[model samples]
Target: MRGYVAMTAQEVAEFMASGLFDVSDVYAPTSQFIVDHQDLDDEEIEYTLSMVAAEDALEMKTATSGAACVLAFEVPAESISESHDMSISLSSPLKWESLECLFEVSSDGEELTWYATQEIDANLASWLK
Candidate 1:
């Protein structure tokens, strides 16, 4: 995976939200996909549901091999003392040519770790020889 462009979770988030990342032909969901296959944790579900509610633009990362990118956001505090944050990680297989095959993971700020949630669209899956 060397020489593949790498970005931090914050960088990925900014790329998605700020439109710096090109999203042409990419799937930017207005809501989390309700698939029966994968089940997300509470924190992961919360992040996905938030995306459903917000209009922020989203983007996918490019991968060379086993590559991953992360998108993070700060959840509005329920109270002044509460600060909840979440991050979603997107992964792709070796030499992926497009956003297809991307999968998702979520992280709560407390542990700074990710939990698997969903598999992204595989529109380009057939493009492979």
Candidate 2:
């Protein structure tokens, strides 16, 4: 197979939770950080999440910076309809670099979007390293 695969929100959530991306170094510390500081408001929390997401994305991009990878985000919605909703794009040039794989975490925590190239989709595990 050699095309984009559109995964459902549940599929994305499951993939994200499957430890496929080796994000331990990227996101495992937030719990301790939050536990250490108990007075963060909504804005602070949101900002922290955004920063973490951005850093993770940058790390991925940096790894594939010069490779055959192209990472991008696809925006289905032009504007933010809710304050706590966000969408992120994670892409790479390998065999699946042509389309956008969206990672969306909605404010209600009820939705997610993820896609990938069929040929190298399973290779994300190795790539994240």
Candidate 3:
């Protein structure tokens, strides 16, 4: 965690232009493990997932086949306040996972809040982990 080089968007954009943050690699879905970080408890994972990727500005993948996929987001806009919009998708090849989000991040980058129907598989138990 301490090794990551966090930079301002301007610096990041410059690096991106220079191929520092390879866009393809940055977003590539992988199981090719980096530092297999210690497992984070459900409560420790702070996230906002209320919208769909196809419809909402942001979307969260529902858990499937016991695996979950969600978007790692950044609030880059300035006009949004209180609440905004998003689109959540619950899709997976696993067939057992249903990804759900507790809420959404406001456009202005406030804390998390969400819509009502943002759960993947309600039947999935807490014992799976």
TM-scores of the models, in the given order? Answer: 0.20, 0.27, 0.23
Q: Which candidate leads in TM-score?
A: 2
What lDDT score is found at residue 21 in candidate 1?
42
Q: How many Å off is the CA of 16 in candidate 3? A: 35
| Candidate scoring better on TM-score of 1 and 2 | 2
Model 3 over residues 16-73: C-alpha lDDT tens digits? 2453232211111112222232363323322212122212322222232221222232
Candidate 1 lDDT, 1-129, residue by residue in tens: 011122333444344345444321221221233242147654555445434322222233223212233323221222112111222222322222221222222222122223221232231222111
Q: RMSD, model 1, all Cα superposed?
A: 15.2
Q: What's the best-to-worst order under lDDT?
A: 2, 1, 3
lDDT of 2 by residue, 21-127 (tens): 31111221234455654687655654454444544443334332311222222222321122222332223222212234444333333333333544335644434
Q: What is the lDDT of candidate 3?
A: 0.24
Which window of 10 residues has the lowest lDDT sum in candidate 1? 75-84
Task: Report lDDT (CA) for all predictions.
Answer: 0.28, 0.34, 0.24
Better of 1 and 3 by TM-score: 3
Better of 1 and 2 by lDDT: 2
Kindly report which residue stretches of model 1 are placed more than 4 angstroms away from their true locations once superposed. Answer: 1-19, 25-32, 35-42, 46-68, 73-129
Which residue pairs in model 1 clash with each other? Answer: none
